[model samples]
Target: MKNLSLTPFFILLCLSFVKAQEVDISGKWTGNSYFLGTQIFTEYELHQEGNSVIGFGTTKNGSDSSKFRLVGEIKGQKIFLKGVEYVYKVGKGCLSKAEFTYSNSGSMATINGRWKGTMELTTCPPGVAGRVDLFHKKELMVAEPVAQSGTSPQMLQSIHKDDFEGTELVNALADRKYYALIIAVEDYNSPDIQDLDNPAHDAVSLSKTLNEHYTFEKENTLLLHNPNRSEIITAFDELASKVKERDNLLIFYAGHGIWDERLQQGFWLPSDATLDSKAQWLSNSTIRDYVGGIDSKHTLLITDACFSGSIFKERAVFNNSKAILEMYKLPSRRAMTSGALKTVPDKSVFIQYLNKNLARNTHPLLSAEQLFQSFKVAVINNSPNGQVPQYGPIGQVGDEGGDFIFLKRGSR
Candidate 1:
């Protein structure tokens, strides 16, 4: 040995070994998993002994359930699990053998991986194949592929102004599901009405924000651009069919709205609507009926079009903050409009202010009522045209004096 210094070499080897060692993944974790473009709420409870691990988990989608019985081994920072996911279909038990492999995300607290399975059920005819992208429950609960900004408690406090009260109750929105139908009709068949400048772009921007910040499911969000009357109705019907009582439904329309003085009602002009045919325009009452039929716990209609205030029957009275959990259980129907039965500028001051506030809102939970108040204030203060935003309950609809809850990501 020619003056071999063993210290540095020994430390390097030890560090390499430590780095390659498997992390301890033993705990309860809850997160969302995506399969076929739908978000599924998932939970895991695992117990590890030595390198071997055993666990059971449950996945929920509305009323449907998928239970898993798992056995796995942790090997060099990766976990390999083999399990049978028992799912109920047509009142019978259907089982699928699944394999999941999760690699440590440089932290023992979290892991993520892909899950694949094949089903050969007794009740069904052919075998089915399925694959899902899943992840360990992260402290910051936002959409994936986008890193969390990790706003601290101090930052949250600093951002919340005194005007918006009851922000401490924001965590109540965590368990609720958000569904949105965003419609923007910039192009129209009639040449006399003129084309819009920003509705389609605005709709897309809103949809992206909803997914990135609010955890809206990809499948549940309907982004309709320049859609005709039938298409609009079909979109609403589809959303109504899938929504559940634990969910919140948002219907946003950015287009031309006509106030029929003779009928004392408002109509949303679709892409195919012509000046000659009033029948082609979709009535607010018809839209209300479609929204009221949904099983969602809360429904909000946001319109940037002209005469948008015609959507609400009356102004909402109960704006105070109650127990958020109990508040979520109550039904609500609300609307926020750009202007009170007047023509708003096509540039969209309403959505601009609304987006800015919502993106910066630090409250753990923000109610629709609070959101509307902010919109009203901002639009009145900023807009040169003085387009007064309106907010209230949909008349004769299911307005139960309850407000819709919006969860701020990582608020908990």
Candidate 2:
């Protein structure tokens, strides 16, 4: 036989091929599966070192974070990880195993697997607690498609008055069993009010429009106009008292919003509220406290006001961040404001663009994030002076996977 030497170049080529065939199942992944009668989606960030893997899982629920360890090997095209499960709120569960088939072709590798396990509850000690059976499967794919221009005009027309049909959005929301509250306030009581003649007329007209179009199946909506501070407080208190498990609560406020530095929070400037008297105004924290006190699974807070961003300040006395973050992490609560800190609220813009646009679109449901982006763009485009609204997750966006839309037009 002819003598042949294996050169370094050939050896390196073989090593490259082996590496290419190997799948690195590291980094962050979002998994969705139906478990225990609820659709549970979790975000897992994992790190693999040598033959051991460690990671944490954040579920759709607001449970405490969970830590997971995996010890397995890659055999041919299949990878296996087996170990005990330790969830934050739910403690050490039975031993679980994960099996995945990885296919490496080009830049991406597809991982398909199933995870079956029983979880324990750490919060409830001295008791084994109920067993949690879970199943997880994943598929690799390209990024989610972006909103396209093809859907933009259709969405825009949906929000305009010319094409708007009353109650279409409201009825659609009712079909989804969404309990929504719509509040419209037009205050003409200001000392510098130039529009004195149309105060009641404006309020009545807005109320009629909302009432004529929106319908609530759960009858959970509260519509108020020019309510005094005490009235607003009482209304909210009554609503807070009625919360139940798995309930969806929505608080919609449309009014003048002011930030009092002395109090260090925002306030919905009721018609009768005066800047001079601190006692007459309701603090933003007070509203948050009321909402937070409600033991509901989800809450949507929408405020349309100038300087509405002040409500989200980090140093407010009744810092809502804790509760907001908790509820959001549970993926149950969301909040949106019309303007940013120090930004002047454009009431006309909110109604004409934001609300109207939501009433028009029929496809590609808009999300809160998407709405914020579109609203910002629309405001800048329509305004004589370019203006942009400020928005961000009160907690983390990953927690709340669902999107919000006005039911009438299915536009978010």
lDDT of 2 at 286: 77
lDDT string, candidate 1, 1-72, tens digits:
544688789899998778656566565567766666877776766667778877666677787765555677
Tens digits of lDDT, candidate 2, 348-380? 464456555444434322344555555666866
Best by lDDT: 1
- Model 1, position 62, has a per-residue lDDT of 80
Superposed by TM-score, candidate 2 places the C-alpha of residue 260 at a distance from the truth, in angstroms, of 2.4
Count backbone overlaps in model 1: 2
> What is the model-wide C-alpha lDDT for candidate 2?
0.51
